[model samples]
Target: LLTPGLRGSKAPAGQNENLQGLKEKLCLMGDANSKNYRPACSLCPVNWKWFGGDTCFYFSEKEATWQESEDDCFSHNASLLMLKRKSKLISISQISQKRSYWIGLSYGVDGWSWIDDTKLSTKRMDWIDLSSKQNCAYLFYRKSRVYSENCYEKYPWICEKAAVQLI
Candidate 1:
């Protein structure tokens, strides 16, 4: 029942440990000199989760093909989740215990890359298998890995968009 207050790191007794860890992990993220301190609470949409750096993430409850999922995200003016680091990917997966969610990665004929056409880093993919048939990526929470699947298959997805700011 506890929520993040405007300031301070207070939380209920049993929840403090998890909250503290989340705060610590989040501390390692985002720009230190950014103007907006906590944009998620005030700027992000109601259903989206604030993911530091003015990024709001929306986790879908329903399943859809990768293309369909991307279209859905576009409908909301967002894009498929496109994280690069393994630890960052796992952190987001931990929050979404629901199931695997389609991300913004795929293996095109040229090579593996994110939706924005950025190449997937070899160092980051070192531990991943990248099976031939499975081209699209998803956050596999049970294993804390970014596993791939056939893009035609259906799976729940995550959408990412910047928190709206009025300047």
Candidate 2:
């Protein structure tokens, strides 16, 4: 078995390709100059995959209602996504694929709503889909717009927790 610090210190042949692909994708994503750099998920309790950013996101295949998903995320000290601008939304879309995930912002009794203490304002809000508002929000690949999906239908999710911004 080849140990991590091998004699030659070279990665397996195919592994380099995967790394390159990920790099290319990230390069295409461009810089993080927008105001939508929100936390996708945080890994303080159980260790999950590291998503490069300070935050961590999860893709749950297990089906559950929207409220149930929110409860699950809150239990872990994270909340759904609440994008601040179009650029941020696009950045998130790139990270997430076809699998849908719940975000913090949604349409409630008042029309457009967000989790308590969301920093976004109505003027800076951008809805993936203005027409679709079933009950909860779901993000999908190639979706120029967002969809309102049932909470019970499980999909991938992105969580967010505040980080101390460096001055």
Clashes per model (N, Cα, C within 3 A): 0, 10
Clash pairs, model 1 backbone: none
By summed lDDT, the worst window of 10 consecutive residues in model 2 runs over: 38-47
Show the lowest summed lDDT stretch of 10 residues, model 1: 1-10
Off by over 4 Å in 1: 1-42, 124-127
lDDT of 1 by residue, 1-93 (tens): 234532444456787677556556544434657875542322577889885556789999999999999999999999999878766676697
lDDT by residue (tens digit), candidate 2, 84-130 = 66765777777675666776756666666667645336473455664
TM-score of each: 0.70, 0.56
Best by lDDT: 1
All models: lDDT?
A: 0.76, 0.58
RMSD of each: 10.9, 11.4
